[model samples]
Target: MNPTASSGRSPWPYPGPRPGDDDPAGGGQTIADVGEFELIDLVTKGLTENDQVELGPGDDAAIVRTRDGRTLCSVDILIEGVHFRRDWSSAMDIGRKAVAVNVSDIEAMGARPIGIVMGFSAPGDLSLTWVRYFIQGVREECDRAGVSLIGGDITKARDITISVTILGDVGPEGPVLRSGARPGDLVALKGRVGWAAAGLAALSRGFRTPKAVVEAQQVPQPPYGAGLEAARAGATAMIDVSDGLLGDLGHIAQRSHVTIDVHRSALGMPEPIRAVGQATGIDPYVYLLTGGEDHALAATFPPGALPEGWTVIGTVGESSTPGSWAVTVDGRPWEGRQGYDHFH
Candidate 1:
C-alpha cells in the first residue's frame, strides 16, 4: 500500500476524463478500494517540485528553502459542514477553496507563496472518485498560484476536514503586518467584497442566486501577485477580507491604534451584489460592510499611491475615540455587526 513515485504502478488514469465522468452513475468504488497509499500516488503525480523544495513528498517531512533567509507561514482549516457543505460545493470548489484561503493569509502578509502542505481527514467510506477529484482540485489551485504541494498526510475521520499550511517568501521589503497603518493613510481593497456572503445568504434561503454569485461563494479568487506588488509599492498595512471588511480592518485598527473611516459612497456594492440584495430584501450594505470570506486584500497606502487593481475605500485617521481603535462610515461609528465571529 506504500505507493511511491518510483513504484512503476499508477492506481488511476490521469490526463483523461475526471473521476465519475466515465461513470455518471458513480459505480461503487470507495476509498477503501484504492487505499491511502495509492490515493497519494494518484494525487502527487505531475505535481511540480520547485527548486525551493529541497525534499519533496514521499518523505515524512518536506524541506523548503526561502530566498531571503526568512520565511512566512500561515495555516487555515476547513471542516465540512462548518466552513462549507459538500451539498453546496463540488469537490473541485472545496479543494480550491481550501488552498485559496490559506494562500490569502500568505498574501495578506505581502509575501509570495512558495510551498503548500495539506492534511486531509476523511471518512474511509468516501468515494474514491470523489477523493481523486478533490486532490485534482488541490493540485490545480497550487498550480494556479505558482507553488508546489510539497507534502501532506491523509487519515480517516468522522467528517472531511482539510488543514492547509502555506510557506511564503517576503523578499527584502519584509512582511506586511496589520499594525503598520497610520493616520492619513488611504484604505483600499483589491478584489470583490460581500459577494460570497450574499451568495451564502442565497443558498441559505434557497434562493436561486446568480451564477457569478454562487461561484463567488463556492470558489474565491484572491488577487494573486497583488500582495507582493503592494508591498513593493510601500503598502503600510494589509489584511485579507476573510471575515468581512470591517472585521478584518478592525484587526488593523486594533494593531496600529488607528481609526479607519470608510466612505460608503465610494464603496459601492457591485451590481451583482446589489441585485442579490434587491431580490432578497436585504441591504447590500450589510453584505458589503459585514460579509466575510471574500479573501480580498484590504490595505492602507499613502494618498495617491494605491497600487493598480486596488480601489480606494476609506482613509485612516488617529484613534481619538473610546476603545482600542475604531472604524467608521462617513465619520460615524457603525452600529451594526462589525464582522463574523466564531462565537457570539
Candidate 2:
C-alpha cells in the first residue's frame, strides 16, 4: 500500500507480442493451444542473457555470480485462492505482485537483486493468454529492478501457484539484519501501509473501491531500492512490512531486544484510505496498524541519517518489561489483532 505511483508501463526490455500477435481471429489463444514446453518458449522469448547470470533459463539449473563473497536469498510462494484471486486480479497483476513480494525481501536485507528463479504451476485448461500476460508482468517487474529472471520450473496443478526465489548481492557493508536496532534509533517507513488492507475491505463489502486503492491491493509497488539506500545510510535494523506495521516491527524489536514506539500522528494516512475507512466504518488506524501486504520498508536509523523517502514515525527504546509486546503506538501497545498467519 505504498503511496508511490506506479510507472504504469511494463519496464521489461521485451514485452512480447501484442494481443493481436496471436490468433488473428481475435479470440486469443489458450495455454492448451500450446503444450507446456512450447508455452515456456513463448513466455521466455525475450528474457535475454545477462552477465550476472552466467546461465539462464532452459537449463536444469541457473548460474549467478555475486560481486561479494556472500549472497542473500529469499523465496516465497503465492497460491491461487490463498494469496490472490484470478477474478480480482489480471494475470499480469498477479505476476507483478509475485515478483514484487519476493524482491521486497531482498531489498529489506539491504541487497540488490541479481537473479530470480521461478516455478509456475497451473491447470492444463488455463488460458494461454493468462499465462502469457503473467510472464510479461513478472519480466516487467524484474527488469524494473535490474534483475534477471534466470531460470525456473513449470508444471501442472489443480490451481495456479507461483514460487519464486530471488538472489541478491549485499555488497561490502553486509546485510542490514533485523537484530541491530538500538535504543534512540529512529523508526522510519518508506512506503504505503493501509491502502491494500483498506482496498481488500472495500472489495469484500462490495463497496466502490477507488481505482488507485484497488490497484494497490492487486499490484503492490514496493519501494524497490529503498532498503539498499537505508543500508548505505547506516540503518540499524530493518524489515519489509508484509505483515502489519506493528507486527513486523515487533519482529525487529524482539530480535534487537529493544522497544519501538510509533507516533500515530506521523503515519499521515492518505485521503483515499481515510475515505475507504469512512465508508467501511473501519478506523484508518486499524488499517495502518493491523493491515498487511504493504511490503513497505520499516527500519531503525540514527535520528538524522534517514534517507530521502523515509518518514520518521517512531523511536527505538529499551524494553521496560521483558515479556511485553516489542512495538507500541504513542507509547502504548497496539490493541488490534497482530497480522496474517497462513495457518492461524
Candidate 3:
C-alpha cells in the first residue's frame, strides 16, 4: 500500500480543476493554501516510469539504468522575469519549454535522454491550477522525448524559477564533443532557427496574429532524434542552437581550433520570418544569425556523410590568425551583436 494513502491523506492532493477545466484563468486554490508536501504530491502523482528508471520518486534518490557505463548530464535554469513572462506564456508552455531546452543539451552531445529531475520554486500566491497544468506540460514533453520524470524538489520563492537537469547516455559510439570539428568538415543544421525570435518580436509589439511564430516563441519544437542520427552518421562535432546560430557555432570553432564560414544563401529566409522582419523594419538575417532559444542542432560531418534532414550551411576551415573571428558570414565578420547576453 502507498505510504501517502496509509497516512489517510487523499491520493490526489490537487482535487481542483485540471488542464482543460473551465478555470483557464487559474483563479482557484493557491499554493499557499495547499502548502509544500501536498504540492509535491500533486506534482509527482501518476508519473509514468520508463525502462530506464530503476527507482523513481519517494526514494531519497532515483536509480537510472544506463546502457553504457558513462552518463551525460546537463542543467538549465529559467527565471520568471529573465527567461519567461507569465502574460506571454501559460504555465503549460513554460513547463514544456523548460524540458525542451534542457533535453536539447543532451541531444547536442549525441546521446539519448533517459530522465530528468526538476527544481521548481514559485510564489505562494500562485494558483494550484497553474501548477497542475505546468506539471502536465512537463509530463507531456517527457513522454514525447521518451524520457522519464524521475524526481524533483519544490520550494517557495518570490518569483517562479525552474531548474532542470537531464541525464543521458551516449551508447557505444561515445558522446560527441564540441572540439571534434576538423578544418575540412561540413557544417550543417537540423532544425528551425529564427522562428522564436520572430515570434518574440511579434509579441513585443502587442500583435499575435501570426500564430505559428508566436507559438514557436512560447514552446520550441526541437528536432529530438536527429542528434543520435547525426552521431551514428559520423558527425565530427555538434551543439544545441539555444543562443543563435553563429554564436553557437563560434563555440565549436573555438574549441575545435577551426574557423567556420556560413553561406547566407544556404539559409534561405522563411516566408513568415521575412514578413516579421518587414513589419518590424529589421533584417531577417539578424534573427537567423543572432536570435536565441531555437534549440536547433548544428553539427559538422565529413564530406558526403551528411544525414537526411540536415542542411549544409557552412564549411570548417583552419583559423588564419590568432584572435581571428571564430565564425563569419559569407566570408565577412558579422557587424552587430553575436547573440543573447544575460547581462546585456
lDDT of 1 at 68: 67
lDDT of 3 by residue, 250-285 (tens): 999998989999999999998888888998999999
Query: For all candidates, what are the clash counts?
Result: 2, 4, 0
- CA RMSD, predictions in order: 7.8, 5.2, 8.5
TM-score of 2: 0.90
The lowest-lDDT stretch of 10 consecutive residues in candidate 2 is 17-26
Candidate 1: tens digits of C-alpha lDDT, residues 1-344: 12123336344323322322433334768887888988788778777887788887888898888986898888999999899887667777888889899888988989988889889989988887677667878888888887889889989899998999999888877598999998999999998889899888877776535657767998898998889989988999999999999899999999999999999988776888888888788889999998988899999998877888899999999987644698898899888898987877
Of the two candidates 1 and 3, the one with more favorable lDDT, higher being better, is 3
> Which is better, 1 or 2, measured by TM-score?
1
TM per prediction: 0.91, 0.90, 0.92
Angstrom error at residue 22, model 3: 11
Instruction: Give residue 77's lDDT in candidate 2 (0 to 100).
Output: 95
Query: Candidate 3, clashing residue pairs?
Result: none
Q: Over 4 Å off in model 2, which ranges?
A: 1-28, 321-325
**Could you tell which candidate, 1 or 3, scores higher by TM-score?**
3
Best by lDDT: 3
Model 2 lDDT, full chain set: 0.83
> Which ranges in model 1 have alpha carbons more than 4 Å from their true place?
1-26, 321-323
- Highest TM-score model number: 3
